[model samples]
Target: TTDSGVGSTPAAEAVAQRLRAAGFPEADIQVIGPSARKKNVVARLHGSGKAKPILIFGHLDVVEAPKEDWSPDLDPFKFVERDGYFYGRGTQDMKGAAAIVVTNFIRWKQEGWVPARDLVLALTADEELYGDEDGVDWLLKNHRDLIDAEYSLNSDGGDFQTRDRKPYSIAVAAGEKKETILQLVTHNRGGHGSQPRKDNAIYQLNAALDRIAKLRFPVVLNDVTRAQFDALSALESGQVAADMKAVSRDPPDAAAVERLSEDPYYNALLRTTCVATMLEAGHGPSALPQRAKAVINCRIAPGHTSAEMLQTLRETIADDGVEIAWQFNEPSDPPASPLRPEVFAAVRKATDRMWQGVVLMPGMETGMTDARFLRAAGIPSYGVSGTFLEQGDGRAHGKDERIRVSDFYAGVEFYDRFMKALAGG
Candidate 1:
């Protein structure tokens, strides 16, 4: 188990040191970062100098887990297997896959096997926080040549849905939504609590929030979403299936839109979504609120701009009194990576080889990942983890996180086939 942000460096360095001890050359291994506690480990294996290298990367970081919150029998750090599941903090979120990648690297070296093209492993740091000292961003800016590859395969993406322990679909993330934060601040003169005015800052802020809630960004579809619906339609039944097929059409079905909009998950996929996440108002309980502010968090759809969304917010509120501004750490979002046929084909072949008859679907992730940075850096990255978790059992960053032992072992085999398909034997 690893601490959310601080554990990445030591854990990564430990992996690098182990590789070196296993006779891996020092020139091919590096522990790079800004400080001692925040390092990223990178390693490479030389192959025939024919094709561009393929990157297999995952962050060592996992979200914080407190022992007090978990069941007594389940400790966050202790590895335990019960009822076919491996219980641990980072079991499902990522360390499971991270360990798999590192193990594969070691196994390949021990077996004296080399691929047709070079393979790079970038076990990074600060991906969970994604602050100024992001590992992937630093590497791209300062040491691009070290980890640069034709494309990258990240364990953060592909999602497997199962029911009753039977795997259904393999959803491979081809793109992801961008994150944007907008601040809505309302300022007014404070008077005695005895005289509450209509233009009170708190009242104005509440009104603005109501308007924002009622406002719906226009429905838009991209290549990824369309393919997602096309593939998902087969799995769904009744109105859900019809709605999925309808949304995939050139002119989306309006009734279908209304129906799906009722569901938050599908609604987020249909268009950019915004919600008031943080609120601040009033100095004291007895005082009139002089200033009221809120932080609006948005997961914007691909091909949409924060500027456009801000404009829409202003128009939706239709009020000049509420002042709005972008957050200081606004996201510098990258363009959605274009879907490539070969990449999807490779994922499908790998999935079919491991779990035959499982559907491979293209998806756009609502949450952000390091893949965005790689995509912006001109390295097409895909999220295609081999592990399967039940439909509602994805305990990422949640309490009592665990993973199926069978799925964990299966991923090792899946990745082996996947790398061969992409880089050739």
Candidate 2:
């Protein structure tokens, strides 16, 4: 297990010991790098040599949750059970998944069910704050042999019944957007606050922001996203379904794109998006600034490049004085794991066994995950956590995060069957 934010070392060590006590071999389990309290724990259960190994991945780190904002009786780290839900910071996003993986490992060992392939569980850290230190990035760079596998199931996809309690849930997630951070700077001659200048850096920076906010990039749909919308539309009713069907049949219409973009979820799938997250200007409140800067977080859609997005920004801002600098760039294309018949069949069979014939659709994730790294390694990867949830729970990365205990155990069953089916056990 790993920890996400400040003070993750203790939590990571605690979870490691728990795994050891639960019958994981001490030599096979290794905790690496809790730099800034970030750490990743890896364990494996060797299988009969019937199929290639599968990697089961989950993040141990979580974003910050303040004690005051939570319920008075709630503790972020304390696992609580109420209303069939297991509540805690990492419940959904996703210590629960890690627990499921660990439990299954033990169960498989106890049952002596040596199936087709080996299973590697990588509970990683620093996934919440970018994967620089103890997360997938570090693993891929430093310890590839330990967790390398034929395919990977990165935690973060599954079906959740909507707020209205729909009977079906979507089982999908294939590709993800590439994350890029850019800094925009506007500079001007320093002057006293008492004497205002029209071309002051602050004014220029605000103007650039205004232009960025108003401009909308053209929509470009890839195969994965198109498939996702089609499957989702098939499951819905009313105009939403109709809109999705229309777009699925033809290319993304300007009108439809405009409408869908208004919804935060659909907007991300359609095109690259930029959000200005941080701003700084002037040395002090009383001083006039010589320079102003803003940090823009851009998620480049598949088929888009950072260079192209940067060029688009330059054109949109249209100010020679405003300069842009790249803070970080990890250019990625959608992972090339084909929605092949065999792979799809495996997922479908698993879903049918678990959910009694629920529709399984292919989806592209808006947020990035470690699948990108595995894909880069020429390994096929998919996000296929079998746990289902109720929509609008606002649990992931939010306060009062929880997952149904039954659902957690169900995921274990699904994954066990999935591995067996995939490796031909």
Candidate 3:
């Protein structure tokens, strides 16, 4: 169930009605929650054999896009095909995958092909806006039985060709960084704007923000990232490979880590990162603000906790007047799903068959996803998508987000085969 928009419900019922019209039995398909704009769309393709169903998951929610900022041709809700790509708010960020899943389900039914394992499709809500009322979170909490499965594929990772469209990098997100909201508050005496006080709250808050901006958190590597770096190192050139290898070693080579940190991607993987995102101060035009607050969004490494990170931040920006407040903290470590024989073999065999020996690297996602919720429930979840995107597609949450039509269709093929193989075994 994807949040239609913030408080708005998605048009999932319309999608659900379409599924029912496509020959899905009423019992085989279930729409949970109210019949509002946003709701979960669930469809089951019953398997023939004894294998447990494989849950195929994606979100229907797209971040809100202001029409004024975009080009006249770009409308967030309209699915426009332009330059071989589908232009929509949810095109690449996710709804495209959902559409593929829905299409695959309908096609599977039409073919009358019963798989070895059932395929469960769940399109959920409230992901773009991080809230407790998320579909996955709600399901895990209230309706765990509906999602019982041996394995699942989240809609976040996949193979994408290089800028030159040569080789492909098929990333499988094995884990993700945890989120910690750090609130920093500085208190000082209030006075008229014309007559400023020595201990101004804004000034003090600015100093803390400045320190946070300049301060560098120490690098802390984990098992997943180590493997990622090692794999990338093998593919890179002379200096790049050498640098990546150095940083991937035990007791990380400080020089190499420092140098590689210059590259933002590798840098974030190696350390706990904190960025100041929101700030608030002052009430009126002529009044001096008594208190100032800034929110720092920090993605903690596996072993660290919110408290520990907050303490580090407090110590880093040493100031007795500035007090740190925590807005929210959720543990982000995914339960152990070994990249060893059993799980790895299935993924490798499927990916290799589809991509013709593309590199399948077990990587950590910098951003969070529904996989975290599943992992917390002792279910092994892998963030793998079957599509590919060209270079310069922009980050998931960035502007002009898009995915190629070929990539979308390729995902259907890859997932169809991959799911069949996984369930067959």
Inter-residue clash pairs, candidate 1: 158-383
Cα lDDT, all candidates: 0.84, 0.75, 0.73
Report the C-alpha displacement of residue 206, candidate 1, in angstroms.
0.4
Off-target runs (Cα >4 Å) in candidate 3 are 1-10, 49-52, 158-161, 193-197, 284-287, 331-337, 340-347, 354-357
What is the lDDT, from 0 to 100, of the residue 6 in candidate 2?
56
Best by TM-score: 1
Which structure among the candidates has the greatest lDDT? 1
Give per-residue CA lDDT, model 2, range 140-224, as digits (tens). 8889888888788876554445344333765467677888888999887787778776778899999999999987777867677
> Which model, 1 or 2, shows the larger TM-score?
1
Please give the lDDT score for candidate 3. 0.73
Error of 3 at 349 (Å): 3.6
Candidate 2's TM-score reads: 0.89
Q: Give per-residue CA lDDT, model 1, range 1-425, as digits (tens).
A: 25444557778779998888767999999999877777899999878767789888888887788899899888888889999889987788788988888877887777777788899999888777735365888899999999889888888776877777877898888788888788999988888898787778999999999999998999978888888988889988999999999999988899999999999989988999999999999998888989999999988887887778888999999999999988833456566667878778887788777665687888889888888788878898888877889888889988899999998888888777777787666
Question: Lowest-scoring 10 consecutive residues by lDDT in candidate 2?
Answer: 158-167
